[model samples]
Target: MADELLRASGLESGYGGVQVLWGADIAVAAGETVVLLGANGAGKTTLLRVLMGLMPAWRGTITLDGAAVTHETTDQRVRRGVAYMSELGVFPDMTIADNLRIGSRFAPRAARAAAIDALYARFPDLAGKRRSLAGSLSGGQRKMLGIAKALAGRPRLLVMDEPSAGLSPLYVAEVLAVLGRFRAEGLALLIAEQNVAFLDLADRVCTLERGRTVFTGTTAELHANDALERAYFGLT
Candidate 1:
């Protein structure tokens, strides 16, 4: 992929002594949306952590825009246009506006203010509660705020972990619609999600089994493979 935005080859990482990823490889192209699917404990979160520099990779090379970034720090990666939204969502004690400020802190003062205003306009629910603590929001609203904060940074590649987790159907639809708008705007996304509903937003799907990437293909190709379904979803 000539326009590849991020690529990881032979990725291996774990906590303390336990190895979680075993030679996982994945790539994301500019303006593309790649969905990572796996069962619980399949190393999905670990992979995201390694990519974001939150954890060290025991062995592998990570490249962003064709430059090696395996050794970069989390802040370094963020400065290089990579923004991550963890599965846990936002800082509960912080006000909604404060959370957005934290995410957009890398921008200039003028740009940061503009970004916050844009976020408020984009997420009216959060706008109404901009002064409220994040802890006061519902699970779904927190998810929305997390995503909004990530976008406030103006990231080129937004890596999200389970953006739809614990949301009602209505919130799920709203989240999907928001993602669709970003996709249309040519933002690259690498999302780790359990929800199959995200297939509609993905340009490609990568499946992991036991910390290793076992499949990479289009949604149509994934739907046609019963073996992959069984391996990733434990379906018959």
Candidate 2:
């Protein structure tokens, strides 16, 4: 495989004294879409926070293309091209245009306009909302804005938390379509969610129980047996 865009080994983290994640290991290579599957309180969100450097790692290591970033701060990681997109719409109070501009702070001023245009062309639904306040957009459109902002930052690894959460079924399809386009363009995604319906769209699926990765492989491996899927997801 190509170089791993993001990798975490023996990663352990949590809040206060209670651990939310323990020795979770996963890797996303260039051009791969990896789905993280778990039920509520499964530590999927906590793992994403730790890997993004938003939460401190009590143990283990995170490497980006062979460079150790385990000790890097959130800002440092962002500078190194590890931008994360929260499920909550980013920049909901600002115009869609301004929301896009804020994420281009690291790029040369000359490229800002071109980046916006490019993103607009890539996502026309968001293009229509360019002049509107992000808060006024639909849930799907707001999710699009969050993703577009992350793309504006030129990130190598897109760590997303529940990109399809709290959306109408139609909106879910829209958001998943955007993710498909990104996947085709060779972006690495580390998505955490309880939505099993969309997990099959990913290149691989990994399940987390408590804080440990109990399974990691293709979506076929995960869904080949209905009983296994139920058991893996705590349906049993």
Candidate 3:
């Protein structure tokens, strides 16, 4: 991964009393879409929080753009060009426009309005809902608004958690398509997703179990040995 934009080696984190990630090692190159797949409670969210600097790392290292970010503050990370859009709406009560504007907190005051306007121009649906409260948007729209808020800051890396979770079929497609669009924009992404079908959109897929990585491969390999996925996922 010579072009890798972000990397984590021996990454471990969790509640103060215990550890969840057991020396997990993963990387995502510039503009590449890398997906992390795992069963619920497998430390997926914890790992994301650690990468975003929301949770302190108990041990190990994290690098963004080849520079060590192990000690950077969460806002420092954001200013360094990594945007996180958690599955939970981080801006629930704010209007779509406000949410995007709020994301500009890390940006220079002079550029904030231009940034928001650019994102609004890109996501017309959100632009349409700019005046409406975010709580009033449909589930899918809320999800889109969250992503748009992150993108408004013009981040180099977009880390999304279950962007398609709990969405209707149409919204799911829209969300996944947004990820695809990220690739075209040359924005690297590290996504945590539950739907196996979306694996087709990823450049690489890592499957985790009990906080350990068990599989890292291409979609064709996964599709050919579907049983392996079932076995790894405990579908039986």
Candidate 4:
């Protein structure tokens, strides 16, 4: 538990009186990459939103780095070292450099420029496209920009929603490879994904079904579970 960076228990939420998450529980340890896998419409994104504090949890407790943050605002969470990369992410109309600068806006004014520079160093392509509009980039390039933006804040925990969604296979590998580097750098990651490509990067896997966690274990355990494929696909 001391190694845990983020933990959510008894998570429940819904829209317009229709419940989607039912007492779901999950956690991500420091420097660990935990993959949330499930079929479409399985509440994967909803769960990520709840954990990121973008959406209120109806009944749950969320702790970030040993601090209770169930009620914390999204910005507050970011300030507390939690950064989220949404499915499509933000700042589509801006230039790559501008988007990264905005990510460091909450940091000390004197350090913001340096932070953006660091991100550019890490993502050289972004540096080359600094003046290019984010909307002009390819799908993979956009995903990279979003990730670079998240890292500009130097977060301890990175919550990404389907980073591989709608990406070409080559782009998916590139994106996942970038995430792999983050894990190596001791940044905890909680990624909601339907893509098995994420499996290779995960330290553990949690499969959700109808807002409930049906499986939580190492990659080996997940592979050994015969019911996983069926359960994930809603096959009888």
Model 2 C-alpha lDDT per residue in residues 108-131, reported as the tens digit of each score: 689878888899999898888788
Per-candidate Cα lDDT values, in order, are 0.92, 0.84, 0.83, 0.88
Give the per-residue lDDT of model 3 (tens digit) for 76-145: 8999888999997557787777898887788888898998988888789888778888988889888888
Best to worst by TM-score, what's the order? 1, 4, 3, 2
Root-mean-square deviation of candidate 4: 1.8
Higher-scoring candidate on lDDT, 1 or 4: 1
How does candidate 1 score on lDDT? 0.92
Better of 3 and 4 by TM-score: 4
Candidate 3 lDDT (Cα, 0 to 1): 0.83
Query: Which clashing pairs does model 2 show?
Result: none
- By TM-score, is 1 or 4 better? 1
Model 4 TM-score, 2 decimals: 0.95
Candidate 1 lDDT tens digits, 80-110: 8989999876899999999999999877678
lDDT of candidate 4 over 1-236, digit per residue (tens): 56888899989998879999998899998889899998888899999998888889999899987899999898888998888999887588998878988888677788888889888888888899899999998888899999989888888888999999889999998998888887898988989998877989988999999999878898888766778955544455
Error of 3 at 103 (Å): 1.5
Give me candidate 2's TM-score against the actual structure.
0.92
lDDT of 3 at 120: 81
- List TM-scores for all candidates, in order: 0.96, 0.92, 0.93, 0.95
